[model samples]
Structure formats: structure tokens, C-alpha cells
Target: MTISSPSSPQEYIKHHLHSLQFGEGFWAFNLDSLFFSILLGVIFLSIFHRVAHKATTGVPGKLQCAVEMIIEFVDKTVKDMFSGQNKLIAPLALTIFVWVFLMNLMDLLPIDFLPYISQQLGLPYLRVVPTADVSITMSMAIGVFLLIIIYTFKYKGVKGFIKDYTLHPFNHWAFAPINLLLETVSLLSKPISLGLRLFGNMYAGELIFILIAALIPWWSQWVLSLPWAIFHILIITLQAFIFMVLTIVYLSMASETEDH
Candidate 1:
């Protein structure tokens, strides 16, 4: 099989953005997104688990120290923001923050690194960052949305949940229908905004990386790429933090009583 180089700037961006997909229409799957997302999840989880399980009371290894700092940071954030006590929120927030950061970190690698390697191994194409895919982001946000709904029902009861949509904001019986419409839109918008914000940021970052690689002179590529990569480090971390914080905030809201 021949290794075909991208023919032009347009073709390059187009190819880079294309997922290794299968099937058709609504039934289609982004194989590349799923593959990389799962792989990164496993990798990050395994390392953290190993470091934690083998953790000692004495001096910690560098890897253990780093992992502990991340865990502490996430734990502290959960404690500060989440009001109600549920054993699940801290770990969930930790997983989300680390998993998202790892996915975004893929954008920092040389634009052609993974794709070139995959092509050499006879794979058609690959996009390593999963958060760049809107579907992947939506799926994650929907998972969080489901959790919020679960907590709302658990804490507030079915009646309370219904009442939340129907009352309180407008606080008048005549405005129940109007309040429901407004609150329903507000509730649904959480996941939609969560997903789109991450997707848009990541997709734009990946596109810029691809643009830098495709449009610049090969001899001087790193000049712009290096700075962009550096700035993107902040972006990757901030995006992950924002996602986790918003998830916490949403769940916190769900667990709150209307009387409070």
C-alpha cells in the first residue's frame, strides 16, 4: 500500500478532521474518537490506580506525588463546590477532569505523529482527540445530565422535580405553563451548552494545529506551532477544569431543596 501525502492545504485539513468512521447516517460511528477516548481513559485510570494502590506512608515516588496532587486538587474542588453529601461526586469529578485533559493533550503532539504512524500500520486515518468530536462531547455531557436528573429525583422526589419545572421561578399558579417551558429549556440547555463549548474549543484548536502544519513552510513550521502548543496547554487544562466545575455546579443545583 502506498502512503499518500496530503495534496493541498484544503485536503490536509479535510483529512485531519475526518474521523475513521463506519456505517452510515445516524447509525454511523466515529471509530477513531471511541478508540482514542477509551484508550486514554484506560491509560490514565491505570496509572492513577497503580500509583494509589501501591501508595505508602513513607516518602512517595515522583509519579505518586504528582498523582496525589491531582487527586487532592480535584477532591478539594468537589468539597468546596458540592453542598450535599454523596460519595460519588469527587471520584466522578476526578475522572472527568483527568480524562478530558488527557484527550486534549493529544492536540499537543506533532500534527502528523499519530496519523503518520497509523497510516504506516495500514490504518486509513486517525484523529486522536475525542473531545473535538461533537458527538463524543454530547455523549459525555448527556451522561452528566443523566446524573443530575438522578440526583434531582433522589433528593427532591418526583413531585418536587415536577414542581421545579412548574413553579418557584415565577411562583404563581397562572404561570406554571410558562415556567415549565422556561425551566425545561434551561435544564436541557445545560447539556447542550456543556457539549458544544468543549467541542467548539477543541475542534478550533485541532483545526488551527492542522492549519499551521498544512499552510506553513516545512522548514519553519515549529515557529508558530511551538507557541500555539504552549498556549494550548492552558486551554487543555482550563477546558477540563471548566467541564468538571460545571458538572459539579449542575449536580449541586440538582441536590438543592427549593425551600433553601
Candidate 2:
């Protein structure tokens, strides 16, 4: 099967941007993102399970060493950020980090490879990176936001959560309204920021890949794409790390008492 270009750049971007949706407009659900994220999560979990099952103290394998390093890093970050004693936080943080990093790493694949394969198989569109989609990122962020609210209420109680919001920073009758309003906005902004940061970075990186692909003279595409792909490794890893750390920080803050 021969791969053909779209009629226009708009068409090209539109083809790449379209998600496998399950519904309409605001209610539309991206089936592609859900599928890819779940797939990646399963893959990550499988790798971790295999490593753990085969782990030995006598001599560490490469996969075991890598997993251990990641675990230690996540453990340290959790230790530093969270002192409220939640058994689930560290594992959750590590999963988020590894899952997101894997999703981001999808951008490293040849821009045309998946689309070409999909087209050959009679599927015209396929976006491999779930985090690159705004809807997916926003959904993850919103989930985290809800978790923050849940943990806040659970750890601090509803009254305490509200009290902290009202009394935080500047605690005065006059400042109460302003403080509450500001605090409310801050809480709402967290998910939006988290979503936007990941979406923007991945979206931009994907766009650059598309642009680079469009510049192909067949022979030179491989040479130019190689360097761009190498540089993108850094971008993907950095975005994932940033997203993971921010999620941990937000969760930790939510779990904090009034003193913190």
C-alpha cells in the first residue's frame, strides 16, 4: 500500500487530530485515548510484575536494576513530599510517572509509521500518544483534582478543609472572603494547569514531528528526523517527570493539615 498526503496542511493536521470518539461534542469520549492509556498501564504493570517476580538479591538483572532505581526515586520523592502516612500514594505516584512517560515516549516513533500501518489495515487514523490529546490530559487532571478533594476531606475533614481555606495565608474577617475566593480559584486551577502543561508539551512535540515529516525529500527525511527524535526524548521525559512531580505535590498539599 502506498501512503499519500492529504490535500492540504489543514487536512493533514485534522486527520492527525481526530480521535476515536464515542459521543458528540462536549459529551464526546475519546475511545482512542482510553484504549492507549489502559494498554500502556497494563504493559507497565506487566513489566513491573515480571521484574518483581524475578527479583534476586544475589545479582540484579538489568530490568530489575532499572525498576529498582525508579522505585527508589519515587520512594524518595514520596518520603520528602508526603508525611501524612498514606500506603497507596507511593505506588500510585510511580504508576503515574511510568505510565505517563510511556505515553509521552510514543511520540518518538516514526511519524508516518503507525498511520501507514493503520491505513494499510484499512484504518485511516491512529494517534499513539494519549497524553498528547487535551481531553485525555484534562480527564487525568480532573481525576487528580477529585482525588485531592477526596483526600482533603478524608484526611482533614470537611470542616477542616473549609477552615483551612478560609483561614489560610491571611486570617481576618475582612480577608476571609478574598482568601476563600483566592483559595477556591487556586484549587480549581490545579487540574487546568496540570492538564495544559502535559497537553501543550506533547501536542507541540507532535506538531513539530508532523512539520518535520512534511519537509521530507524521502532520502533526507531519515537523517533529519533522527536528530529531532533524539532531542524529543528529553522533552517527553521532562514532561512526564514534571507531570508526576506536580501530581505528587498537589496530592501531598491536599493531604496536609492546617499547619502545613
Candidate 3:
């Protein structure tokens, strides 16, 4: 509805941090994050589809050229990192990179722009940066984790996958239990670390933006914010690239039969 302007800096930061949430713990959903994420994803697909449909061999449009560049970059990255023969890896990596980059790109928007519009439309809260949300990042990580399991089974066979957990690091009957424990922790840590790393960086970036907005004088805000915003572009792009590369590497490791 009609959210009043915050009276103090703390109130302002708190208001900005709040999500448009529904339901209770576990069942609760961050509607803003979900909405923006899906919207950006659709936008990514639509732009690519339009470019591909209109693509010409001679004198390509700027949009087509940009799209082709991204596709080639992602294809090359996957080719370099993924040793497996699966056809899905390249497309998956491309989607992860572009989709996550789009989400992170939202953080560059003026912090109050969307929220102010949303307030006028009667939405109570809106957090536009989906990658800053732990649940969103973790959900993507879980998807990658599931793919790792599937690839391990497909390329290594069930027996090899079992041996990966049982007869690994020490490679002895006496060390099987210890190996299982160590491998299990390592396996679980993949998703956790993957998700948390993204969330931590983006959340911190979002917080700094909020602080700049809340604490700085309106007339002087741009003096500091402009430089930070420029630097953030690099951070967002690097985070997306790292996520995609790590996904490719993890799947490659899973596909290999030999232990590193």
C-alpha cells in the first residue's frame, strides 16, 4: 500500500532491505526476487530469439552481433572446461551466465527507482536484485548439484559413483568409512559454497548501495555512487562468469572416471 518515507537512516536501510514476502517460514516466498528473476529470464530469451530469427549472413545488426559474440564466448568456455561429451553443458552454461548476469545487472539501477514505482502501484516492498537473495542463488546451486549427480551416474556408472564415495582419498578397505565421510562433506559443500559466494558478494553490494542512498545527502550522493556503480559492473560480470565456469568444471570432474 502506501509506505511512508523512513524517518531515519536505519529505517531507510531496513525498508530498502525488506522483501515483498508472503506466507510464513519455509513456505514464504520473495515475490519481488521471483518476479524480477522470471521477467529478466524471459527478456533474455526473447532478445536472443529475435536476434536469431532476424540474423543475416551479411552485415549483421548490432543486436545480432552482440548475441553471436555471447554465444561464441560461452561455447568456447564450455569447450575448454568441460571434457564430457554431453550436448547439454554448453547451452546450460550459456543460460546460467546470461540469466545470472541479467539478475545482477538490476543492482545497477537507481536503488529507489523501482521501489518508488512499486509503491505507487501499491506493492509494499520490492528488492530487484535476485542474485542478492540467498534462496534464489541456492535454488540455482541445487539445480547444478542435481545435474552433477546425474552426470556422475551417467558417465561413471553406478559402481564407479559408489566407489567415488567409498574407496577414494586413501583407497583402502580400512579407510572406506573415513573416505565416505570426507567425500560426503565435500559433495555437500559444493552447493553451499557456490550459493553462498554469490549471495554474499551481491548482498554486500546491495547493502553498500543502500547505505549510500540512506546516509549521503541527496545533492552529493552521485559523487560517491557514480564511481562505485562503474566498478560494480565488473563485479557483476565476474560473478556470473565465475559461476558458469565453476559449473562447467564441477560437471567435468563428475564425468571423469579418474580421481584427482
Candidate 4:
């Protein structure tokens, strides 16, 4: 759908960028991000739930077969990357891949579709792509970070965890201070990188779509958008896969026995 005549391209971009937020400053919340994230999650799970219940051995439906394939792919990915045999990792990988994929898939929707519908419904702004929001991306990264911490303690105990941080790569007593700083930064950068990587890719992709819609004539918008959307399909899927793989790798590092 075409957005009728914004006063300028900047105004058009600003309108699309504005989120449905409430409260003040640090306490503010993005209602549209939360709504779409939860909505997409529910939709993803509901479809999977139906597939699970309706699965059959004889001539499975397309949806059921596709889900089974995804389950198998995720299971294989987890088994390959996750060193320890935790049943949770497979399901977690599956959930993360599918959910994040669906979330990123939101970028495929027409740029103005949700916002236009929401405008008519009294909400001023709506960004359909949840991953474009830093908070959502960081929260997912933090959740994985928590799992990494938990598995580290579960496998290595508190003392071993501390020792892993303090003693490695600098065994000399005089080097302990330097080791701690380096280790602390190293440990912290994982989640930071994960969050920023996904956020940057998605935010840029969404912005490009908005810019296309804003700068191009309504009649000519499809010429740019269609190609970008086609390319973005690969990007959306890659980001999800990368997130899943990194989570598996990080958790594997946490749960595995340290090299002597």
C-alpha cells in the first residue's frame, strides 16, 4: 500500500521509524515490538503444535513434512555443535531458529502494510520487524548468555568457573591482573557481539526498505523493493542460523571439559 504524500522524504522516514512507545526515557517500552514479537511467537508455536498433533506416518501433509524436516535439521545442528548430551539444546535450537526466522521474516512484508493498518486502528506507528529493535535482539542474546553461564557452572562448578577465568592463558602469579581484565572483556563481548550483529543487519535492512519506499515513486517502488526482499530472504535465514549456531557453540564451550 502506498503512503499518501508525506511532506518530505525525511518526514516519511521518521514516521516509519517512530515506534509505539510509552513512559519516559529509560523506562520507555516499544509496544509495537513487544506485540509483534509475542504475536509471531504465538503464531509459530501454534502452527508447530498443530503439526505435532496431526503428524502421521502415511503421506504426511506439506506443513507436517516441512516441520519434521526443520526439526531434523535443528536436531542435527545441535548434535554437531553442542558437545554435551543435553536434550534441552535441540528443542532450544529449534525454537530459536524458527522463532527468529519468523521474526526476521517480518521484513518481507510490505513496508507500509502493518503501519497503515495500525494507523487506521488508532495506533500511530508500528514496525513489523521485531529484530530491528535492539532491545529484542539484546534480550535474546542475554538469554543465551544466561544459558552459557548456567551450563558453565553446571559442568565446571563455581571454583572451576573462577579458575577458568583467572588461571587460563596466564599461569604466572604476576600476570593474574592482566588475565582477569582480558577474560572479563572476552566473556562479555560474546553477548554484545551477538546482539549488535543481529540488530545491525536487521535495522539496516528495514531502513533500506523504508528508504526505498520513502524516496521512490509509489509506481516505481516495487522495482527496488521486490529485489531487496528477495535478497533479504537469504539474510533473514542466515541471521537466524548464525544466532542458533553461535548459541550452540557458546554453550558447548561452557559445558565442555577445558583443554589441559
Candidate 5:
């Protein structure tokens, strides 16, 4: 996690973008992203666990009320979008929303705050927003992709799943190969596009924050950064909601039967 002081703005941007890494190539790991992602996940689970444990029927505390509202909102969204009767959808949506929102929320922090703290503690490369890292977002997207596969197979069966790609959209043996090609690309693009979308948006947002900090004098940064930060709150929340809604929609489509 050690980094040399940057001599130029390009070097500064490059340094800030670099991850605390280990290993090489495909085996390399971004330890900072992993650390903060897991940390935020644990925080989300711990708070929800505590709130649920003490939840009361009447006069709920502010924390409990907020948690309930979030749960209800996610539940309603699941009911609206997810037609299948899988109990996992609601919880999965809630987890994705909260976990991703928490990760994106890190971008609102002063770009250098955590990294500076880490540097003082003898670690220099620390990127706090896990969503800004493609690997993290892709991992999550792949998880959803796997769930889509599982649900498709669970509801449609192996033969049906194969036929899904190989048969219709043309419904003839002549078009099976063509159908498979189009369907496979379409299915595969779900995870690829999902992962890249979040990564692109958050990465851009993080870079802008870094740019403001690097280019502006500390005394005047508030003039521009404040407005951007306020607007960014909407971006972060919208990204989280989009991710959650898409996950639900994909799973719903996967869980559909021929009867539907």
C-alpha cells in the first residue's frame, strides 16, 4: 500500500486510481476494494440484525423506523417486479441496494480522507468506493448471473433451458444454431453490461472528485465541490436502485414458466 509522492497531476491521478494489489495478472487481487466491500457489508448486516432483533410493534425508534421503511420499499419493489414465488428475491434486492448504496456513499467522503489516514498508518493506496472498481461490480453481477442460471434451470429444467436458446425466436430446427448464437450473446451481455454500467458511473464520479481535489486550492474547493457533492447524492442512490431493480427483473424473467 505504499505510494511515492506524485510530482505531477497525471501522476497524482494515476496514483489515486491505483489499487493496493497483490499477486499478478488474473490472480492479482485488489485488497483495498475487498477490504472496504466486506467491511461495508458487515456494517449493513450488523445494523439490520440489531434493528430487527429489537423491532417492536408500536412506537418504533428512528433507526427501526428507517429500517422498516427500507425493508417495506424493497419488498414492494420485489412484489411489483418479481412474479416468481422465491423467498430469496426480496432479501437479495435489499442486500444489493443497501450494500451498493453504502459502497457508493464512500465517494461523498473527501477523496483523500481515507487514503491519507491509511498513509499515516503506513498504507498509501486505498480506494474506498468498491463500486468504482470493475472487479467488485463484475463479481456482484456474476453472482446475479449465476442466480439467473439457477432460477432458469430450476423452473425451466435442463431441456427447457437448452431449448430456450436453441429453439424459439425462430421455432424451427433450421434456426436453432442462429437462435443459440443470438440468445447466448444476449444472455451473456446481462452480466457484462450490468457490471460495466456501475463501474463506469462510479469510476467517473470518483475521478471527478479526485480532479476537484487535485486541481483546486483547499480554500476554494468548497465552492465547486459542494454543489457536485450534493448532486452526486442522487447519482449514488439512483445507481443503487437501478442495480436492485435490474436484479429483480432478471430473476423474474428467469423464474418465468412457459405458462406465463
Candidate 6:
């Protein structure tokens, strides 16, 4: 019987980055991303539900206090950016912040641990961070894009949305073409920015972790990897917060009646 050598660092990283698929060609589904993101969502929702079920008026528990702090922070942000309309906006913003933060936090796990375990269980691939996948990020951005369109029509009406796209900032018939072109470009830029910002940050962070894990001399790997991972806690949190805030801001802009 012949035994195979352990995979090289590059091979290991590449294998881990691959996704579990459900089909071939254009119909393939990224099962790994869907599974992990849904699992994380369930966990987050469970925790929030537990905290809500045990609410207190006199004294707050640690979990309640933490939840309240996050709620207040999200509420304040929405209030400042979104005005007092849109009853659903604040809760949605809060959920996005917490959920994305938790998803990004998955990067903190040991790079090879999940893949190794999955391999043992005969699973071919698993990419844990959904945000690190371009498809996932683009899907999220598209959802935001749809929400923006929906809110635009809801708050401003179909005519208002069209007017804003074709006539805002320049209300003359002669400049209609220019106004329409510029506004269309600006509107399209929102989803592109949303998708790229998240994909870039999470992808870069994952790449760095892979590179660091590839280093030899086990002692040196520990010495450097630990500090980098520690600092990455802040990076992941900030990226998630930025994504959430921008989603709220874009939605707010869509809901606004003014063009400026």
C-alpha cells in the first residue's frame, strides 16, 4: 500500500477555498456558502430571540445589555442617516450589522481546520466565509439593489423614481439625455460599490491568512500569525460595520424625495 504525503500549503489553501457544488456548468449551486450563511443566521436569530424572551425592566443581564448596546448604536445610525420614515429600516440595519459581523468573524478560525475535518468526513470542499465569495457578495448587493428600487418606488412612486433618474439636478428638456445618462451611471454604481467593497476586504484578508499559514518554521508562523489574527479582529468588525452602514445609507437615499 502506498501513502500520500500531506498537501503543500498552496494546495491546501486552494482546496480549502473551493466550494461545494450542487450542479454542473451554469446551474451549479455553492452549497457551502449557502449552508454556512444559513447556519450562522439561525444561530444569530436564536441568540437574539432568547435575549428578547428574557427581557427585564429593573436590571439587565449581560446578554441583554450587549444586545441593547448594539441596538442603540444601530438605531442612532439609522436615525441620523435614514430620517424617521421607513419603520423597517432600523431593525433591518441592526440585523445586517450583527449578521455580517458574525459571518466575517468566521475568518478567525484556523485556516485548515474545517477543510481537514470535512475531508475526513468525505466532503470535497467547504468555504466557510460566504462574504469571501464573489457570488455571495454580488447576490447580497443585488438584494440591496432590489431593495433600493423597491423603496424608491414605494416612497417616491414610480413616476418619482423615473423623474429622479431622468430630470433631477437638471430639469430642462435639452439636458434630459445628459441627466439620464449621469443618473443611470450613478444608480448602477451603488451595487458595484457594494459588491466590490465587501469582496475586496474579505478576500484580501483571507489571502493574507493563507499566505501567513503557508510560512515554514513553525515557531515563526505562530509568532507572526497570532499578532496578525489579533489585529484582524478589528478589520473584520470594521468591514462588516461599513457594509451595514452603507446598505442603510443607500436605502435611505432611495427613500428620500430630494435629489441633492
In terms of lDDT, which candidate is strongest?
3
Query: How does each model score on lDDT?
Result: 0.92, 0.85, 0.93, 0.90, 0.92, 0.84
Model 1, span 1-260: residue lDDT tens: 24567799998988898888888999989999999999999999899989989999899999999998999999999999999899999999999999999999988888798888999898777898999999999999999999989999999999999888888588788999999999989999999999999999999999998998899999898899889999999999999999999999999999998563
Rank candidates by TM-score, best first: 3, 5, 1, 4, 6, 2
In the predicted model 1, the residue pairs found to clash are: none
The digit string of per-residue lDDT tens for model 2 on 29-113 reads 7777888899998999999999999899888989899999999999998898886888878988898899999999888987678
Instruction: Tell me which of candidates 1 and 6 scores higher on TM-score.
Output: 1
Pairing residues by index, what is the TM-score of model 4?
A: 0.95
Q: Candidate 6, TM-score vs. the true structure?
A: 0.93
Q: Which stretches of candidate 3 lie over 4 Å from their true place?
A: none
> Candidate 6, which ten residues in sequence have the lowest lDDT sum?
1-10
Residues 71-172 of candidate 6 have per-residue lDDT tens digits of: 999999888888648788888888788888888888889777886687677777778888888888888889889999999999899889888877866997
User: TM-score per candidate, in order?
Assistant: 0.97, 0.92, 0.97, 0.95, 0.97, 0.93
Backbone Cα, N, C clashes tallied per candidate? 0, 0, 0, 0, 0, 0
User: How many angstroms is residue 59 displaced in model 3 relative to the true structure, after the best TM-score fit?
Assistant: 2.7
lDDT of 2 at 213: 68
Candidate 3 C-alpha lDDT tens digits along 9-45: 9988999898999888999999999999999999999
TM-score-superior candidate, 4 or 5: 5
Error of 2 at 194 (Å): 0.7
**Which parts of model 2 are misplaced by more than 4 Å?**
1-5
**Model 5, span 47-153: residue lDDT tens:** 99999999999999999999999999999999999886988999999999999999999999998888889887878688889999999999999999999999999
